[model samples]
Target: MFAMSNPERPVRLGFVGVGSRGTSMLQTALMLEGVEITAISDIVPERVERAQQLVMESGQPKPKGFTGEEDYKKIADLTNVDAVFTATPWSLHTPVMVATMKAGKYGGTEMPACDGYEEAWELVETAEQTGMHCMLLENYAYMRNVMMVLNMVRHGLFGELTHCETGYQHDVRYATIGDQGELLWRAHERYLHHTGNRYPTHAIGPVSQWIDINRGNKFEYLVSMSSRSLGLNHYVAKNYGADHPNAKRQYKAGDVNCTLIQTANGITVTLYYDSLSPRPVDFIYRIQGTKGIYSGTLDKIYLEDTSPVPHQWEDIEKYVEEYDHPLWKKYGDIAVQTGHGGSDYLCMRDFVEAIRHQAAFPIDVYDAATWSIITKLTEESVLNKSKPVDFPDFTRSKWRERKPLPIVNS
Candidate 1:
């Protein structure tokens, strides 16, 4: 069945930004049957060489490597590469994706596809103008539990979703600061001067899928508030010296940011960004509806009519065997061997399958813009004392006519 959709050979891929995340994704891509890593690009020549070695070790010919700072554009123009996937830093995602789309190749990018309104609109407009799909490879959307919840939602188990609360709640002090107390790129660029949900896509992506954002419904507006900036300072002071520059520096970003959003269809969402705080990872994918609710923190579910006991949360595993998404049901064995609990594998498969079959990507450019623009929107609201900020209609009214994403086994 999967083979029938393809009218051509394997999908040739060019990878930009072969850093840690990019190399990890490249490894995942290598696990697939019909994916060819034809080219690799990174500013660091050593990283490019390492990625090419990984490709060669996979028994394929060594992929051509490009090491110029802006060599991603060259990968976009490569004749052998049919699609380009970038796992560059936040600022580079839009540029690489835009270059790929302009070159008329399929583009796949890591989360928060663009940083601000201008780049968000640019992503939307470029995809529309070039007739190419730029997929936001939001692997979180393909998570097993979330995919099961999505299936349950589609089957009316949730019955008219009313609200959702999700957030990127992981603490990443190590990533933000080097061991020598130097500010990392994330600290320098995102947290040093930004004061809102610097990274919202990880938490919002799956919820957006569940709520059908940018499909039949749109994010209308939001108001955001942030706690005082203290986590990073405290971290630096505790780990380094009390008089360290980082400890004394005033970070514009707060330790915790809370945002409230209303969808055009009347569903409400509560988004949080609490990465600076010292805490374990928690996405809090709490989706509530008239019929039932799911709590990702507890990994439990409750239903008014279907639960064995009234007003009690049942283990989500109870329904997993019956409610598991078809994609997981088909590929669980192999996917579990990869990253992010196999989401990386499934997500890459979706990208390759879409390219091979010339089908619309599951997460298109409009969805990318809608989910990613939250960074800028929340910043605006926080800077203005939690004033309501309207979301730009990236689709420009086309969302009204678009159908919700359909369940796909392939």
Candidate 2:
């Protein structure tokens, strides 16, 4: 358990982008004691003003507000801020975080922190050079179910973890197109024809922790493939008719992206990213070991030679309750009210703790960079005809000897 350096002095945070995700993150932060929103910045004036009102309404002093494209820099550079949390678009994550680190403040950025390998490596170099903390706000890594599995894996209940699978299998066709039926900048991405697992870390984060990836084990190489871009068009045609402008629009993102990864310790992981598909939200996480297997979707568990009914699956709820991640056991209720099925609050809590302690956070710069680089690696593999792309060693060589921080106190 980590404690704030000066427990009496409240942690000051400067937030940029008070839109959908940012608003939720800000609200969660507001709920925690001894935290203050000192400044809020966003490109939209209304969002900035709304965040200012939220902070004032929460009994905190009115936070300074700024609106414009580059105003986040002002917030990041504020001397009073202990940390900077940016929930902006994907392309801006790296730049904003890099700026925060250079300014000597902790930076917590939204997921897929970087779009490609080079930018992720840049973050590594910057964090090391500045000796600043930059964490990936990977909410999935903090989910109660995922953390429970992590605890189970650490206790050796699953035996030696051999291979695992995880993915972001959600239907976001509505978010992509929006209600107006116009392709926003976010959706325009789907209209392009590039291949690879564009988003890999959401699924990889919790699994990496379960298997101690980036610590003793490191991802080696990845082979990726993507189905043609047809899901979005199919959905548009089905609902909006073939004459709908979007139905005729060219989509570049594949219908589905499946990737295979092999770690240095001979562990295999399968990942998926399928946002355009018309399907219910799915987790598709499977933890496989020599002795047992667990499924996130089915909430089912099967162990070799150790079940009341041979070859029959049993409910995993008992295991989850017994081995729930200690972090969640302590704060699951608070997290649940915040968002993302209780993970968002935990993720924010860790980020704030890391900032206050100025110590190695649960997800350090190395984890952020390593997990983020998978996005670019997958793109390369897809463009190269599903050829294997070797993953980068962001740590130089520290991974083999690095030990993971205790995620759950046994």
Candidate 3:
């Protein structure tokens, strides 16, 4: 309900990192109705040039592109740039996001916002202290099917969800090794270097939205376990053994990782993440309630109500059209066509609106901190052989003092 008149000019936007994901976001921003790319920073000179080329191709005023990591701060602090989208490496996200927020600019970062729990806390604290919007851009939350599921859950169609399972299982070994060279940044062997649910945000974020976590309930604790590394490490050893000195040094390619979470309301959510597998992208989201059960994998749902025949999964489009969530009812259509089924657009729109309207972001620092902690704790659990680990009480009871965030358009 916090609509605002279109700005006299587009909101000045900046980007750090013009890699594959960064380039896609840059293009999407250019296509948005009221956004202007004022500046961009990238470590690779070629990437900077490519971003400039994209600006010219899109018929927008060419943004000033800065090269090298040091220059990112300069671009982020630019007076013309109102917000920044950070698609940098996992390790670099903390610094870039923190600097952007400290410079009094809004920021959106890719998933696994930081590499560790402490970094996550720092990012959250900085955003809260500076009163800047910091959104963890987990695009999966915006997928059409996921949004439809969320809408149903919100409407009580699922009827007191007793249990839920979700996961992001995709094979990115080629992209991780081939494109990133032998030193895979996010691969288990290179950067993450630990066994827990390294990337739980994508799966957990949507589930959290459906359940209204951090508002009505919060995660209590979690336990996690992982399979031993295989497949990709062999591929890496054979392909890049000479190029990477550590290629044959027992690569710890992450296998499947699973986490069982307990919510404060006693609801349970099981999260799974796997990247080394050689399977098609599968985000299995399943929920069971007192009245019905919903399964994203089968694209089917079952209900106990006999008054009306349960809706068929094929009727998802109809349901979405007729019974979308209040927030999605307003922006769902536009969101579906955008990246990650329209989540990227909604996230970007919210970031910009928060800046323009001086409103609190829907996903605040605490939410980010909690989600990040889940991932960090999952890893800890894996290291401890799936031992139950207590979730840190980040709110320290402050959440009891706050109400559910209103669905404000701005």
Candidate 4:
């Protein structure tokens, strides 16, 4: 059982990072029935104050606020809290979470829980030794459509899933530069790493569940390739002037990176990271099974059974009633009220419930460590000119003996 033993009262929560994404999660925390924001922390006092205002407006008493350097420690040390929620930048996710686990609380973090393997191992080891839950807040895994597809896969609609493809494709030149045309930390990161799928889990997590990865199957090896970097510099030159120092900075990260991961069961997953391209956002998650296939972009699925019309495409919307995930069936309307098409709401709902009842998190530490550290493996493959890189079985052989976890109550 978790530190939180009482289910009747609200689950006391400590939140770190009240920026755009953090504040969004805070808003959801406000809506969930059994959650109470008790502490808030961020480097920006204004952000913390704003989040505190939201909590107060929700009719709860004012939450304790902490800001500036090392303020997160105050949240982790708070003995009254049942869980710690963090949406900090990539760098702080590990530090805040590691601290929360040490302080003996359930902790949930933004995607890519750790930037590298060593830090990821720390998360696994800590959770294993302490019996604390470390759930990665991978909202994509909870998307209604994705959940439907997962349910279908389990029901044998997509029999013996063989391959899956997913990616995070977006144009974000503006976020990387200041108004005066100075390179930000996000932009500088492109100049720092040679190449990798900087964002992997959003695409991988949903498909991992469908394919039984980190359970009966395991990611074996990966090969990665990147198109040369040009999109960012060109954007800088066009907007900030060709003579701008930002335009002259040599970006190490490629504009487009494609990574192929082969699993121990011979299931392959293709992942891409193209955050700087000139395109609208696209998840482009596609799955192929022995019986049929799914195309997320088109919102359609096809099957070997052609009774109505063999080999014909079927709009997934029509089958929603038949295969809607039980989680979605129960919480679909409430989920849409939160961010990311209601995925955020269900994620938080499940998290709060887990904390209150001391249940195992739906997305446990093994899933968190493997999905997050995949970034590092892809980098090795790309840096080696597309040589294959082995994915470490953070669960060792335990993944083989483990069974698939249910998305909804069985």
Candidate 5:
């Protein structure tokens, strides 16, 4: 662990892939105390320069910049950098993380962290061999309602959790196609050729924490199916001429993909990916247990013992207020100014604090692999008549002995 012996020392950071999302996270990092942006890299030299300007505007020295396709390796090797964070394209996430860990620096990446089973296994094996941490900066896990739910779960308010239903249900058709009706990277990488839960980490990350996945329990297997692909074809044909090549292109990704997972402890989870359809953004975070249930879609709860009336849903605001996570309670006001309803700030804070103190990350590589591998697993299952796919035990049976995540009050 490369901890600063003095906690007051800044956690120097190098950032890779400084596009829109990366730049936003850079701005968020600048809000943190005792953090130094030491270096920046992006395929676009303009983005590298822009990120450097942001760092300089923050009153820090202008960070060194790199723009080569493989420049992240250079950032990983810098002696001044204590950690490296990458918000690169989906295919680049695992490579950047692997490079950083091999260079003996903590690594953080946005979203699924890795897409394929090979990449997932490589991530787990690399972290174990190097004794370095690679965290999936899954911001959803820190959202206000989800964190409160995690707190309630830990406190036994949701007694003996038996089931959960969560999904990433957002329309991103505009993002997939350019104004000129050209295919974007997401269209090629996620929708054009693959089908299944392409983006499951956002939904599964929070659910995993609540169910103690990779801690006291682990995902055993899952079966998945997907609806026919139609949203993108309709979107393209409507916006552009019906004869446009994009409108006629065959997309493999189904508009709605569903996967049902069973945990070693017998908890069941229904996960969904519905980005192609026109819809409001709803994570559909529903958790049920022996005593009560909470519905994130409705933002309501039904508790058998605690409710004043039985069998009726009540507003969850009071329960959230009563069981707010400590991290949220302490940082709510400041975090609200950042992205994703303050989850960005809180999640980044945890990453920084863990690095500063040389503490184990709340969401470590094992959890990252377990949650991220769902993409590939779901794809395999969907293509094979929804056959059951066993989860790779990234923990190697250690989950039976690992303790549940404690409420991180400090």
Candidate 6:
């Protein structure tokens, strides 16, 4: 184990693609101690300028801004940079991450890590060969509710777990309208037409954390199914088709994708994902065990051994304070003031601390590959009419040889 320290000098960091998500991450990075935003790059000149301006406006020293993809690479290879944060498009994550790892710099990548199995494998291989950290910054896993639920399951509060379900559902169809000849880079109608399970990690990461998946059980196989893309197409036509160039073209309806995962322990998890619904944003997480059942949607829990009254869903922060995950006990308070219910701060903190201390990252390469591959696997199963697909054992029994991640306060 490595001891934490206050670095005499701040660790210099570089960011690629400072857009909506990137800007938020940059804001969080600036709030942390022992970190410096030394450089930033984006394909769009305006975004690069805006990010540099934001940094300057925040009263920090302005970072050097670079435009174009090659410039991003140059920034990544800078000797002064200790780490790189890749918040670019999903397709760009793998290549940028590989380059950052090759440069001997730690990398924090946006979620889903990669779009396919080959890219995911290459990322793991490169990170291992380079001996650098490549963490998939799945912010949802760091949320207070997620950590609390993980604690509950870790302590066997819900004994002998048998099943779980979780998902990310939000509607962004209006953005697809492409008003005033604008192109929608993030529109589901634009990029997700050919993809299945467009977003899976937000729902899967928390559940996997709760079950101690990479540390204990591994995913054995999965089968996926998707509802037709009718919803998305309808929204596009009703809102966008009249003035859009592709008005005559049939818009691909987004899918409500579900994947049934079988764990090595014989437990089953039903993972859900959707982005086309006209509904309130929800990260519905539910777990069932022999002793009790916990449901996040109803904000209620039931214990089979006790009285039948459903425990109203109390604040997760309160639960974290009461039966805290050890990581939370030590760092949770420090992170609570930041965004994403404090997860963004904690994720960055862990990544920076691990790099500074030369300790294993909280989420390792294998964990990232597993979740990244699962997203692809889910899509494959959907294409194959929900056929069962075996999950490759990336660790190949190495997890048994590795020590469990220390529960900081446990």
Q: Would you list the rank order by lDDT, best first?
A: 5, 1, 4, 2, 6, 3
Q: Choose 3 or 5, whichever is better by lDDT.
A: 5
Model 1: weakest 10-residue lDDT segment is 1-10
lDDT accuracy of residue 89 in candidate 3: 78
Identify the leading candidate in terms of TM-score. Answer: 5
CA RMSD for every model? 2.4, 2.4, 3.5, 1.5, 1.1, 3.3
For residue 57, what is the lDDT in candidate 2? Answer: 95
lDDT (Cα) of model 5? 0.92
Query: Please, what are the lDDT tens digits per residue for candidate 2 over residues 1-410?
Result: 11235756888999988899999999999988889999999989999999999999999999999987888788877877888899988888889998888888889998778877679889999998988878999988888788888877877878988988888898888777756466765675434555566667788899889888888999999999888888777777777788888888877678789999999999999999888887887777789888898888887888886756877888876676678888887887778898889888988888876676666678888898888888788888888899999988998989989986586422
lDDT per residue as tens, model 4, 1-410: 35677679889999998888889999998888867899999888898899989998999989999986787887888877888989877877878888888888999999888888888899888888878888999999999889999888878887888888898887778888888888876775544455688778888899889888888998889899988898878888999899998787788889899989899988888898988878988888899888898888778888887425687778787789989999999888878999999999888888888888888888888899899888898888888889998888889799899889785742
Overall lDDT per candidate, in order of appearance: 0.91, 0.83, 0.74, 0.85, 0.92, 0.75
What TM-score does each of the candidates earn?
0.97, 0.95, 0.89, 0.97, 0.98, 0.90
lDDT of 3 at 72: 68
Identify the leading candidate in terms of lDDT: 5
Error of 4 at 106 (Å): 0.5
Cα error of candidate 5 at position 302, Å? 0.7
Q: How far in Å is the alpha carbon of 21 misplaced in model 1?
A: 0.5
lDDT of 1 by residue, 1-410 (tens): 11123446888999999888999999999999988899999999999999999999999999999988899899888888889999988999999999898988999999889989889989999999888899999999989999999999999998889999999999999899999998998897679989899989889999988998878899999999999999889999999989999999999999999999999999999999999988999999999999999999999999999899999999887798899999999999999998999999999999988898888899999999999999999999999989999999998999888888888835
What is the per-residue lDDT of model 6 for residues 140-259, given as tens digits with 9 covering 90 to 100? 888766777777776778899899988877666555546643437565423345545666778888888777677778889999887766655556556666555544444443457777
Model 3 lDDT tens row, 83-195: 77888877777788888888888777876787666897788788768877787777776665776776677667879888989997877778667543455566642324566
Q: Which stretches of candidate 2 lie over 4 Å from their true place?
A: 1-7, 190-193, 239-241
Per-prediction backbone clash count: 0, 3, 2, 2, 0, 2
Q: Over all chains combined, what TM-score does candidate 1 have?
A: 0.97
Total clashes for model 4: 2
Q: Clashing residue pairs, candidate 3?
A: 196-379, 335-342
